[model samples]
Target chain A: MRPKTLFDKIWETHIVHEEAGKPTLLYIDLHLVHEVTSPQAFEGLREAKRKIRRTDKTFATMDHNVPTIDRNNIKDPISAQQIETLEKNCKEFGIELFDLASPYQGIVHVIGPEQGLTKPGSTIVCGDSHTSTHGAFGALAFGIGTSEVEHVMSTQCLWQNKPKTFEVQVNGKRPKGVTAKDIILSIIGEIGTAGATGYVIEYTGETIRNLSMEQRMTICNMSIEGGARAGMISPDEITLNYLRDKPRIKTLNNLDSLMDDWIKLASDEGALFDETLKLDATKIAPQVSWGTSPGMVTGINNKVPNPKNFEDPVKRKSIEDALAYMGLQADTSIEDIKIDTVFIGSCTNGRIEDLIAASKIIKGNKVSSKVKAIVVPGSQVVKYQAEKLGIDKIFKDAGFEWRESGCSMCLAMNPDKLSPGERAASTSNRNFEGRQGKGGRTHLVSPTMAAAAAINGRFTDVRSFDVDLGEY
Target chain B: MEKFQTVISRPAPLDSSNVDTDQIIPKQFLKRIERTGFGQFLFFDWRFNDDGSINEKFILNEKRFEDSEILLSQENFGCGSSREHAPWALRDYGFKVIISTSFADILFNNCFKNCILPIVITEEKLDYLFKSTLEFEDYQVKVDLENLILSDNKNFTEKLDIDPYRRKCLLEGLDDIALTLIHEDKITLYEKASIE
Candidate 1:
């Protein structure tokens, strides 16, 4: 049977061959690189005396170790070294790079989409898990390992097996104050983090269909957290409209014609799925991860689940472990959890819209003196846009450290780390144990709710602050 | 290094939902890329105490699963980042079978390449497997790859669902790189032709 869903079509097109006892070899359309993961891969290339086969097909950027403060004074030698290493590697490999001084330089994920390098019906890979973010544009994008990165560097091909396809149909319009983050967190809560495992989650239905490009990106970006290879929505007029007239590649134009092939990517109404999950957008609310892992989320008003309430012994034990690690009582309200830091940016939540939404909540209020909040833009471009609208000044005026663009406290790659035992309310994805730092707790919230957490020093509903979130 | 028929073992039923990759192999242990030694650190964040003692409540610390080589996790196993360390750690720890309702895509593909058998069962079947293990004294599942069949001698039995070619690869213990090399002569001919 011919494939109906975009995932199947992309998979079929990319499949070099299918043989007994072997995975498929996919021809990678684009290869994205960064500092932390590329050093070893580039080192391997140097050792093997191989040049990047096709530099035009590959692109590079630096983000992981970029400092969030005093951008000009990147005094730390290691930080400087990482950026330098990326530049040197890209130059040696004959690949295009967007370094600090380059107007195109930004978060690797953010750069591809912003420049239209990422597009529908293509296969993309990066050495970062959040590479799944590109799937938002109706591409099959996912992260690969260093060895795999080296393999792709040497040969623009990946040894990948096709993933089973799953459909997550989110029906109904979102209620007020609910956001894309809430829709995803609610899905995580329903399916659990590993729910979409071994599948390319093709997000469908009216709700996902209606989301802005940025929101669709956010939704697909978190597909990793749900254990999907990548999450995607079929490109439509919204996608074409978003890509039109952007400062993208010179060759790319007229997305209207492109839509002909793009529209064929969605699953047919009666297409078979390995698994199907349905969600009601209207029922979701502002979500927060009270415990470790994105699946530990609940509505803003919900209480921490008691382990004893779990039916199964294994689940009970797991919940107990989370409770012990978080140092929270089972029945305590999530609203009561105190926080010391508030971070509102990452590839998952660091777009200009996220900043604008966050600024709306904190425009008039002051963050708690005890809370040290920082708003790091996903890219330098996002920073420029936010600054153009005075969003950065508003954030700084409300006591947020409006710092430089890059993945900061989200993983604490640079010096921007939370001390031990510090609790933070963040807009970035992932709340794994010590993900922020050793013994540092993280509660995932939407950017607006993160702003609320900054003001209140605990998790709170964004509605309490009374800013119209505009769209759910 | 090692070749085998499809890896066949019983998933040591851990009936918890949303088993994250971080919980499978935490970020603390991700500092290194040497994939071999991660077995010791598998579930380090979830299985150990802050003081480095085993958290007795964790499944790994349970006596019932001391010799368990297969992991039957609940839905959404290996969610989070596409950390290849997860399957490496699971394989290094000697887990051959990871039967679950679902798994994260990247890690799922990574598993087959590393000789880990990732099987997806229906949720009802998963519930059956989880509960059946509790009742049987041996509760052992035997996967015979040659037959492409899995059965617990006492009650439960099912065929492991996989793509036909993937099934062949698992049975033959071949990976994508190995598969590509199979057509090297043809590729060489094509390359020479293109050059000409």
Candidate 2:
């Protein structure tokens, strides 16, 4: 047999059918659905008179448009309607739902792996773009649009073109204060957003292997931001340990056999990738995105770049437009850029580990009066765990609003949003114009950096803070 | 989904690269259940001033490009978010053909699901289209889906590269779910063999 990449191994195993001039049909093991993107998909299924092929394989949750402060009283009528529609659709289709009242309810990407529904050597698809988050467990997970969502619901399979493989190797030990978010951000900055447009990236080498599963999820969560189909890390002991006792997998009796099969999902030693890029992890600094796109980022220690430094006319123009939209001037130090809000939550960094890292920087400190800071947990279970550990008190004592989980202020589909012209240092994925709200400016940073910014009311490097930031 | 045929109309050139879906249909407008009526909100932030009035300088606002069915843009046309609302808004806004140097993988796939035909041309060819749209007052291009050719009748002609499966679906206005149901038995067998 030809030495197969990890992606090829999983893809070939899942193939159900193929034709000469058509996309290959691959069976999907999990189909995660959320409110904002699934209503129309359900409507399509109803109109077609199609029953869900496998209700057991499907899971629904309400996250994108739910209010983090008050889940019971949803003031936004449209958001209320969307949530209601999902509840009705899930009931009609016999799909299990982790509704607002359910203890498992959270962002679809966050809850999938946290509950162990996301398994290695399987394929996962979600209507939301952050579905790549589940790839941390070596699953060939990727985001699909709503139409494809309907297809997966009806057939438990999807017609997909084979994606080429790209290996991104980050060797050497990461420096203190640098996180998986920083490493991924630096990689995006180096490779323009479209660098891996048609390929799936495998994050390899020493630095990736050394990170925890939660940290790996943060790295894979933003692969879509870099325009890749999906991003993954091969399974190892850390992966096995994380899934060992998860609620969904604990009931299954054949775990030791599963672990043996999961470990072999890693690519063979001599497997060849279509393309490869290497980054020195030791030299990376904590990163912050200063422009509309995630790729337009810089190290926290650096100043905003001038457009003239870029030779490409289009690149230069984009920088100029980003600076104008962000209400920033070239050559200004990043630490001097003031912020009005600090958002520390999303599928990207809303895990329990992220909150612990942020709280370590926030304990015994006061949030700046000029900034309104909020921390949203990724799942209800995460919120329970954080509160049990008293991490919630650490944040609340620092004047940060500790709220329920559900992508709060990330995309701002709910009432939690930035007013016009208000700037936020966010731990979310994209910094696109109006991603948080209309006329709102966003700067992407890690949770610790966002916590430090909350205390300083400006974009400050985490390493410069006097607090002892623990290991991520 | 609507069938794709030949479209002959003036091209609206949006000379921007990495024009994300958030910019195409901002997040505020995504709550609506039906895919229709998004045309009004297409490029809402860019087409209108903050005070709720139209910005006359935007390309789509120009009288010359009114009712344009072909949209010409630069590299990486739809880059962010897996929202199909981007293509729904574009098709609802009367764009049947979109030509760019490159496009994001997910958006490129979503375009096929809608009636929109996303075409990829060389950078040099795209520059010529952009220049023609900017210089000529009555510039029009005819996109022939059946023949896989694009021409402006005056300047140049170029071939289109599209997947045969995608092209067939667009030309026939076929529903993907109905087509995939043909392999229902194979899907059931695969499910039985796999362990969850």
Candidate 3:
């Protein structure tokens, strides 16, 4: 018998039919939708007069354009209209919706896992790229375009070619202060933005197995940044434990039998992969991106790389342009770079654990007078949990604005955006040009590092802060 | 979807790499439910100043490139965000074809669905195209999709590579939903069996 990779097993099972020359009709288990990308997709359904084929498998939420500060009223007319459109579409289609007023309202990725909608061996997709976040549950998840969204909404399936599998193995324990975010950023930096193109990356290693479910989600969330179609970590005790208390899982009658199947979903021994890369996790350090792309990252202790060091003219030019736009000097230490704002939330790092980590650092310290810091939880549940733990108070007492849950300052679809030329230490995923705001400079960092920057008013090593993590 | 057979039009060069979708169309303009009418908002941040005046320095705003239908850009064009709006905005803004050294996966796939041909050319060939666009006042190149060839009248031609499946769909003006509907019976069976 041929040994099969995990991706092959799950993908092959989902195939309705595949001919010699046609694209595979892959059945999708879950379809997550948000405000920004679903409007046109629903409109496509309306134009064609097609009803949603399987509303039971589809879920809608309003996140991207929702303001984190104000829950009752959205001041921006455009933002309000997009949310309203999503509500009308979901109601019309008879799909489940977690609107702004709903307790489950949060980032789509966050709500999916918390609700146990993302399950092992399931194939999930959303119009937003962070759909990869669900892959942490051992699902084959990836992002799709609006047209593909409409197709899935109408048919509960997609036309896709099987992507080759790439294995990324990280061995050894990650050094203290180095997180899943840093590890992913370092991997992206080593392999440039397009390195994993045309592949689905399966992350395997002792280090990966040891990570918490939230940490694994953080790693998979940025897989798209590395250009992979998706990233997956095989489900284990950690995954099952996280799902045990989830609402959906609690409704299951045969939990033990389901767990048995999930455990067997791992790739067989001697499974074939198209490519493999191994890294020593002990060597990874807290990373920061100095350029517009997530791949332009280096260890926090390192100096900004000079463009002249690049042999490729295209790379050299990109580095030069990024430096000019970011107001960065070549060979200068990253620690010396001052930031005007610090954002510590997004689908990438807005989980309860992430907020707890940031709150530990900010417990007794005040945010620097030179900086304006804000923390937005990933979901309303996370916000509620933080309040129960008094983490919100820790942040607010530290001079950081403890805002409501949403993708605030990540893409700046709302009022919480950086002014032109303002620099931010962000915990969100992408740092593309004008991603946070028009002409804003973003240096991607981890939650702890973002909190450190808030207190120091500059990019500082989290290890340098002599803080105790008591009862965090 | 329009059938894309051939296109011969003036090409404008955007000499930048990693041109993400956010830059192509800012998130603020993505509020509209309709896919059309995105032309005015294409590159809104770069093409216009904060005071609502045109920024003359941007290449698209230059008089010579105003009517160009083809865009020649560097590698990794449309790198961020899975917005179909990126391609829609480009097509709505009058771009019939995009030639780049490479394209981000989602954007590349979205182009075929919208009938906007995204051709992948080598960096060396891209340099030649960029040079030609700048050297000539009204540079025009002929893209023959049937033959998978890009040719300039003056001593330049390059063979492009595209998936035969995508090429056929583009040429036939077939959308994915329509094609998938052909297997609706099989899909229905699979869904019913899985539920049971």
Best by DockQ: 2
lDDT of 3 by residue, B69-91 (tens): 89999988888789999999999
**What TM-score do all the candidates reach, one by one?**
0.82, 0.99, 0.98
Regions more than 4 Å wrong, model 2: A466-468
- C-alpha lDDT (0 to 100) for residue B24 of candidate 2: 97
Q: If ranked by TM-score, best first, what sequence of candidates would result?
A: 2, 3, 1
Interface RMSD of 2: 0.8
Please say which candidate is ahead in lDDT: 1 or 3: 3
List the candidates ranked by DockQ, beginning with the highest: 2, 3, 1
CAPRI grade, predicted model 3: medium
lDDT of 3 by residue, A197-296 (tens): 8889999999998989999999999998988899999888888999999999878998898999898888888998999999899999899999999999
The Cα error of candidate 1 at residue A90, in Å, is 2.5
Poorest 10 consecutive residues of model 1 chain A by lDDT?
Answer: A248-257
How would you encode candidate 2's per-residue C-alpha lDDT over A211-300 as one tens digit per residue?
999999999999988789999999999999999999989888888898999999998898999999999999999999999999999999
Candidate 1: where are CA atoms >4 Å away? A1-3, A19-22, A43-51, A70-85, A253-256, A263-275, B1-19, B23-77, B86-103, B112-178, B181-196
